[model samples]
Every structure is written in structure tokens, then in C-alpha cells.
Target: MGVVYIGDRAVGKTHLALELTSPQGNYVRVFLANQNYQNLRANLLNLDGTTKPTQTIEKRSLNVEVRLPIGISKIAVDWIDSPGELFRRSWQSEHINEWENFKEMVGKSEGIFLIVPPYREILQPHIESENYVTQQQWCNRFNRWAEFFIYDCSQARRIVICLHKADLINCEIEQEISKLNYLPHGSPLNWLQRHNYVVNNYFQPVKSELEKINKSRSGLSVRCFITSIYYRSLLELPWIYLASYL
Candidate 1:
């Protein structure tokens, strides 16, 4: 069993996957991008500022697998890091046949990691600007795509919503949770209950959107989580929860 990361461009999907699967430890990681070999290599080199003479990584599109031991047992995770920009733009094609083809390809994934930047709270403004599709349209497209992926793969329960760049808003969530507990009629005995309520409220809108998708995409389950690659402490709880699930 493994997890798949899906998000818009430069959302740190590759970086998070690498950190989780790094060889320095005992995690096995693989990268699957939508681009062809030549383009992938150029992007990596440009992003890393590596010298052309010392580029040792292969510039090819292949499924490379790695194995690592977890305590006495071993687990294999397959990671797919596709081009977010391409996926989003592919929806704008004029040909219905081509659009269906693209949708069919994405529907094969095991799970989805929907990454949204914390700084970009509302979806409307971002989607309305040039060089991007409207937020409403993006949500609709994702809903349909997710529905297809779940129906085809039979693994909709693994969907995870990741609020990336959450370090910027971690303190806010904490404060909000605390404040909710102290509300006029909030709970008195269970702090967890209060925290859960606060978290749910914070994500209520996204959850509603997901619910609309779920109606059509029936077997799929969606869960929300906050994550920040740059914040070590912010990741502790999420990692612990994931470890328990593993």
C-alpha cells in the first residue's frame, strides 16, 4: 500500500516524497512525473543549479523501485509525482475525445493527495486570473476526475487532503482551537473534542466541496490534514498518525 501526491505546480510534492523515502534512513521512495525524460532532466538541473558535467541522475521516464526495511518487516510505497501544471491545463482542451483520454489516465491512481497552499485560502480569486482556470471549474474537474479514479481503482478511501505550507497557519489553527474551547458553551471535559470541532470548522468549506464530489464518486472517502515540509514540529503529529496506520 502507498500514497500518491497530486497538486498544482511547485507545491513541494517532490520534496516531501523525497524526504519520506530518503536513503539516509529506511524509507523507499520513487518519483513518477507526467513529463518525458528530456524535459524532466532539464527541470531537475535548473531547479538544483547542478553543473551539466556532474549530472549523474538518469534523464529517463521509467518506473524505478526501491526497497527498505521497517523494523523486522519491509514496506513498499509507489510514489507518482506528475506535472500539476499539465494536469490542470489539460482540462481546457477543445476536443471531447482527448479530454476523456486524459481523464481515463488519471482515474487509475490508488489515492489522491490534494495539495492546496495555505496562503491561498479562497479558490475563487486564484482561478479567475489569467494563466489559470477558474476555481469553480477546477473544483468541478477535480470532482469528476476523482470520481472516475475511485470507481476505476476501487481505492477511494485513501484520499487525503493536504493543506500544504501549513507552517504559515499552524499557529492560527492552534489559536483557533484554543479559542473554540473557551467559547461560551464549548466543552469542559474533553479537550480533544474541542480541538476536533475547531479543526472541522476550519475545513468546513473544503469538506462541503468534497461531499459534493463524493455524491457522484460514491465509495471514495476524503480526510483533511495539515502539513508543512519546512516545519519539523508541525509534521510530528501527522507522521505519528501515519506511522500508526502503517
Candidate 2:
């Protein structure tokens, strides 16, 4: 499957992709991007779950090709890890060559990982009021972009709303959880942890938009995945994105 990862900067998009595709000895990984990273291999493929590079030169996107041997047939998967600026600048603005490249990738994508920050971060307000308003408008535009890919792109089969930075959310939930242990039996902490309240709240807006797409498209699927590159393993099974792809 051709999977493209799109998200704003510093949301751990590249980290998650590299973590999922790290050396299993069954795949040959290659980079097709034109930009240079300070320490791409160590930063991305860190086994200890390191999520940040010393410094990134800030490229428009990072492209990866993973060739996996499925029996005798070697299947190649192309992943485009794009910077959020692509969407920020391209929205209601000039569609530059980079934007065109992004469009083509999305057009040919079989599955897409639209990465966004955690619930609390998403709910946080922009410092500038005008920028906040612009962001809301851009979100609508992004929804339209998503609609185009789902309805018009024949190869687009699935769109997964990936909630990035699960580690942070887990910490938040745990902190709030500790205070509730003194309460009566059957405290809300149990429900919050069990139901994945942070992720569920963050996914609601995307779910509402894509529920229509799911209904309209006979075979198209819109789903959600919560992930964290920092955690050694997952508290919940869904945080492991490799399973989602394979």
C-alpha cells in the first residue's frame, strides 16, 4: 500500500514512520527526498524511541521507500512524510511545485495517516486571534482536500486519522487519574483510561467529517489510530501503527 503521512511540524510524523518501518531485516529502506537531515538514521531509527533530531533543515517533506519481501514477491511501499507547512502555505495560496507533489502523492495513496496533536494541544488557542480564525478556515479547506482524495482519487482506499503524541496524553491522563483515586468507588479515571478519552475527544471532529465519506464511498474506509514514538511499547493495542499498515 502507498501510505502518505501528513502532519504539522514537530508532531513526530517522521519518527512514527521510521519506527514502524525500522530494520526488521526483511525490508530495504531508502530515502528519495532532496533535502538533507543532520542525523537522519540515528534520529529516526533510534531503538530507544528517540523522537527528535538534533536539528532539522526543515524540508517540505520526507519520502521513504520500503521494499518488503512477501514470499518470492518483493512489494515496495512508498511513504511521503510531509511537513505541516505544506498545508499551511498551500491553503488558499499558490499551489507551488511542492504542493503539486503532495497532491500527486495523496492522489495515488492507498492509505493516508493524517497526524494531528493531542486533545489538549488541539484545544489550545492560537496566540493571534486572526491566525486562529484563519486556522479554522484552513481546517474546512483541509476537509475539502480530504473529500477530493476520498471521492475522486480511485486509488485512495483508506484515510486513517492518526492522533500523534500519545505519550504526552497518557501522562496527562495519569496525572489527572492520580487525583481521582481518593474519590468513591468506580471513579471516572477507570472510564477515562478504558475508553481512551483523550484520543476519542481529539478524533471526534475528524470522525464527524469522515463519517459522511464512509457512508458515500461504498468501499472506502476512514479510521483512527493513536500512536507515540516515545513509549517503549503501547498501553493500548491500537498505538502500534505497524499492525495498522500490515
Candidate 3:
């Protein structure tokens, strides 16, 4: 089995990959940083803060792979972790090259794990110009790439979308409540109503966007899951789902 991470930069792709590898008892880990040949060579020489500190905490980096053990079966998982900030102007060349490499890896992949933050939509700019692309366009491009890979692979693989940082939403709600309380005549009911609107109108759209992307694709099985490292119960969903495939 193969696993690939697809998303914009700093979205916890690498972190999630490490978590999966750490739990699987018999797995040989490999790093495939989204750096040039020269940079990757240097990265090997500088192994500071690379390995996981404990079983609970997972490390995040550019790219990594792990070989899984399947008794009497020749089963293995090659995880391809790409850079999160793919469209940065300074790293455009590296981004394109890494994406090409990602495509090649996906051709042989049996599964894909896509990670996107719930609050990212609110933070990303809605810019459109010769030099800038809207977040929606970027998302569409990402979906298209995944669609192509899923289309190419013959094995019936699982596609999981990890809605990371769900806890952050709760935190944001609390922060808003605190801010509202400073008002001379603040009302808890009013604050709750405002926060509920934000949750329904803002974060809910993310689910709709993903469902739209999945509906357009054929043959591949897709599952959306909400997760937080702090929330043990939610983390189990992805693990249980992945195990079903094995």
C-alpha cells in the first residue's frame, strides 16, 4: 500500500504522516524532503529535530516514506510528503518539480490522505490577478491533481480528507465570547448566536467544497473526517478506516 499527502503548505500533512508511521509496529521510515538533490543531501547531514520525540507527538517536514510489515505478504507503504507551501513565488520552480514528483509517486499509490485546516478558508485571501490566484482556484487545482491520480491508479484505494484543527474552531468561539463580554451590555445569547452563524456559514462551506470535488470524481472511495491530536476519540476514525483496507 502507498500513501501520499496533498495540500498547501503548513497544513499538517507531514505531522499526520508521522503519526501513522509511529503506530505501525513494523515499518521502516524514509524521508523524501521536497528539496533539490543538493538540499536533500545537506538535509541528511543535518538531522536535528527530525525523529519523533515520543509516540504521542509526530514530526512534520517536507517529505517522508515508510515501509510497512505484512506477514507472509509483500505489502509495504511508500508515503510521499510534499511541501505545504507549494505556490510561493520564490519556490515556484521547486514547487513545480515537487508536484511532478508527486504525480509519479501517486501513479503507484494505493491511498491518499489529504489534510486541510478548517479555518484556512477564513484566513486565505480572495485575490485574483495575473500574479495571484484565488483560494478557490488553488483548491480546484488541488482537487484536479488528486482526481487525475485516483483515475490513474487501478487498485480500489481509500481517499481520506482530514479536517484538521477542529479544536481551533472551539477556541475561536471562546475568544469571540471573551471579546463580546467586554461590552457594557454584552449578552451571552447574542454572542452564541453570532458564533453559531460563523460556524454554519464559514466552516460548513469547507465540507461542501470537498463534497463537490468528490462528486465529480469516479470510481474512487472518499471519506471526510474531523481530527485533532488533542482529541483522542476523533483520531481513531482515520485509523479504523485505514485498517479496513488492510
Candidate 4:
């Protein structure tokens, strides 16, 4: 199944891309093209500094295969490094060719990953400031974006909302997990519990919107992940569960 990664500019998308290209313990990334992975790594750093700004193109796509995964023979990934402007400018307003390409990506995607970074840094500021857009406004806009993507890609059975830079969050989720008595209060909660809380709090609304948009879409599965290419590696995580499906 092909999977696409969607997020605004500089939210660890390229970092995640490069990490999988390394000699992974669980899997290996096979680039369909002959482009050197080393050059792409350097390009990531330059991209971040505006030295090489991402162009407003349809996509910077790479046909890749994460081969010999734990539970599967191979996982083919048609990964695209998309422009932040597509979502920022609301491309559907004009129904441009780029927007059509986006539609094609969503239409063909079996799984989707939406990367969300810390609000204060990538999105809006945590506190109100003079000549700055309100945090609530930014939130509303993001929510709309999520709803729109989910609607357009409603048929995608598996969706991953990746919360990037988890260390930067203002209200630590671990602290909030304390107040809830229903979920088994334990020292060092497992991934399932954390994922459930995070998804319910953030992704449920978007899932609901998706259902509303396409009432007939069935067996939809959306997962929330606290993903960091730095703090932790996804390769170590039991992706065999996901690989089995592929």
C-alpha cells in the first residue's frame, strides 16, 4: 500500500524521510531513482534554513520501498515531500493542476500520515501578541485542513496523525494522563493507552468529520503517534503490526 506524508513546512517530514533511508535495523529504504541519499540529507538542512526553499510544485515525490519489514515481504511507499503552500493557500479555491495532483495522491493512498509539530513553533504562538494571529484562529484553520484531508482521503483505511517534537509541547500529556482515573493509572503507561488518549482528544473530531463527509466509507482506522526522528526511532517500535497488513 502506498502512503503519503502531509504537513506544513519544516515539521520533521524530511528528517523522517532521511532516517528511514539509513541502514535500518528493521527495514531498508530502496529509492526507485538513482538520487544519492547523502545529497538529500544535506538538502534537508538547507531546506530548513531557506537556503533552498521548497518550490510550489505538484510534488517532490520519490518511489521507495521499505523492504523486508518484520512481518511483510516488502512495503512499497510512494512518498512525496509536499509544499506547505498547498495547504496554506487553500489550493482548492482555484482547482489548479497542483490541487488535482494532490487529489490523485489522496485518491490512491491506502494510508496517510499527517504531521503536526509544536503549535508555538510551527503553527501559531501559545500566547496572544500584538500584530499576531490568535492561537484559536490558527487552530480553527488547522482543524479545517484536517477535516478537508480526511474527507478527500476518506477511503484510506489507515491514517496516522504524527505529533512531531513531542518534547516541545506546553502541557505534557503524561501529566494530563494522571487526572483520568478510568484508564489504568500505572507507572509508564504503554503505547496503546497514550495513543487512545491522544487520538480521542485530537483526531476524533477529524474522524467524525470524515465519516460525515463519506457516510459509506467503512472500516476506517485512524491512529495518533508521538513521533520523533530524534527522541525515538520508529524502526524500534513494533511496526510489525502495520507491516502484517501490507
lDDT of every predicted structure (CA atoms): 0.44, 0.49, 0.47, 0.54
Q: Kindly report which residue stretches of model 4 are placed more than 4 angstroms away from their true locations once superposed.
A: 24-32, 47-51, 58-73, 88-95, 121-138, 170-194, 200-216, 234-241
Clashes of 2: 0
lDDT of 1 by residue, 36-104 (tens): 434545654465644233111122232333331233222233443433434444443534554454344
Compose the digit string of candidate 2's lDDT tens values, residues 1-246.
456556655566666655544443223233435423334656454676555542312333434433323222222345455444454654426646656666776777676656665543343343323322243553565586566665656676666565666555534644433432322234445423522453355555555565676776676766555556554232122322222343
TM-score of each: 0.52, 0.55, 0.50, 0.67
**After aligning candidate 3 to the native by TM-score, how far in Å is the CA of 142 from where it should be?**
5.6
Give the clash count for each candidate.
Answer: 1, 0, 3, 0
CA lDDT of 139 in candidate 4? Answer: 61
What's model 3's overall lDDT?
Answer: 0.47
Query: Residue 82: error of model 1 in Å?
Result: 3.1
Deviating ranges (above 4 Å) for candidate 2: 21-39, 42-75, 88-95, 121-145, 170-202, 232-246
> Mind sharing the TM-score for model 4?
0.67
The alpha-carbon deviation from the true structure for residue 242 of candidate 3, after best TM-score superposition, in angstroms, is: 1.8
Question: Clashing pairs in model 3?
Answer: 8-84, 9-84, 9-85
Query: Which structure is stronger by TM-score: 2 or 3?
Result: 2
* lDDT score, candidate 4: 0.54
Identify the superior model by lDDT, candidate 3 or candidate 4.
Answer: 4
